[model samples]
Target: MSAEIAPQPLLQVNNIEVVYDHVILVLKGVSLQVNHGSIVALLGANGAGKSTTLKAISNLLRAERGDVTKGSITFEGRQIGKSDAPQLVRRGIIQVMEGRRCFEHLSVEEDLMTGAYTRRDGRAAIKQDLEMVFNYFPRLTTRKSTKTGYISGGEQQMVAIGRALMARPKLMLLDEPSMGLAPQLVEEIFQIIVRLNREENVSILLAEQNVNRALKVADFAYILENGRVVLDGDAETIRKNEDVREFYLGLTEIGKKSYRDVKHYRRRKRWLA
Candidate 1:
């Protein structure tokens, strides 16, 4: 019988440490991997280094005066230490940032077109992808001519994701796609994200604080605390973990407990132990 080759991870972050402005040590030996055609969620609290991890992967740290002080980041087996954001984008890794950033003055369609700026594949191809984006986010079709800033928050979020879709990314770094939106809108955005993953075959590295919500859509998950990955497993296993239930998901053995009831309960630091 012939031997089968193992597939390399689509993205790899190996024991990386991040420092901001040469002083603030943020990510301490943090490491993760996103396999081909899988949705991997990076779960944590606000300061747990989720966004920093995304920025690290996308090479956006330099603009913020941050640096990867240790370890390595590789995309498809090539070390990306010196690769810039534009280069990464050209290579099909796109980051939809946390704040749903878009050009306020640009119409929704115009904002989306910018995502295709790096492509040399010609206008006809770009327009085809734009239509693909609209198909996934049908709400965008109705607001395509409106200035992005004038749209509802949910629509603006749709615009942000739609713009990233226009890039035709192979891997998407989604930072908190559910932030600052209604419950319904959050669900809607996540549904579109899953659709993108399944239909487009785009691998995703999702950074989110919404443990319950992120786990629902994630195929695999890593939980971070104070800049290190504390626990990791398939999404379903992580969901049923007792410590994760009590700490992150706000559930306990009996039932849901108020912060007042569980305030004094010591959260076990499995990483430290």
Candidate 2:
């Protein structure tokens, strides 16, 4: 019998470096992979270059005067280095950026419709997808006709995710989906994300600060510090790691200590050494 060949990655980022305004380097030789139909979490603190990495993949860095000056990013065997944001969207790659940016003036439904602007598939399919989004996010159904600005922060986040779903993405680069929301709302949103990955087969590259929650949902995880991937492994392994438990998950043999305190208390982590 022939050996079964493993499937190629849905998205591959190889040794990429990002710089802002051609001067300030943000990501230093960062690299990772997202296999087809898998959820990969990128966990890190604020300003750890997680968002920058996502922007590079979705080709949205240009708007912020940032550029991928080294290495490459490819989606399904095609290089996307020079692709524009809209062009990437048309190719089934969409990014739900940090801050849950919404068309504040538009109704919830209208905000979602904007996500399908790249599609030429006509209104029937679009309408069907919109209903599917509502199914995943029942709360969105209640606020469909309400202006997005009028909704709560959690609802706006749902609108953002629903809008991305309307794009029917093959790969979704989600940056900080749990930011500034109540714990219950965060859990609700992540449940939907898991459903999207398992049932819809949409591959996800999630950048998150909530380590405990991210690991619970992710198949694989990468930990970043100061723009570099410090450690990476399967979710189970990462969850059990001492450094991860102490630094990210707020667990310690002695007692719970802040990450800043831990950083200064120890000489340096083995990964950094």
**How high is the CA lDDT of each candidate model?**
0.89, 0.90
Q: Candidate 2 residues 177-268, lDDT tens each?
A: 99999999999999999999989989999999999999999989999888888889988899999988887887878787776778675446
**TM-score (C-alpha) between model 2 and the true structure:** 0.94
TM-score of 1: 0.94
Q: Write the per-residue lDDT of candidate 1 for residues 199-261, one digit (tens) a residue.
A: 998999999989999999998899988889989988999999998898888777987767765
> Which of the numbered candidates is closest to the native, going by highest lDDT?
2
Clashes of 2: 0
Point out where model 1 deviates above 4 Å: 1-6, 254-273
Local distance difference test, candidate 1 = 0.89
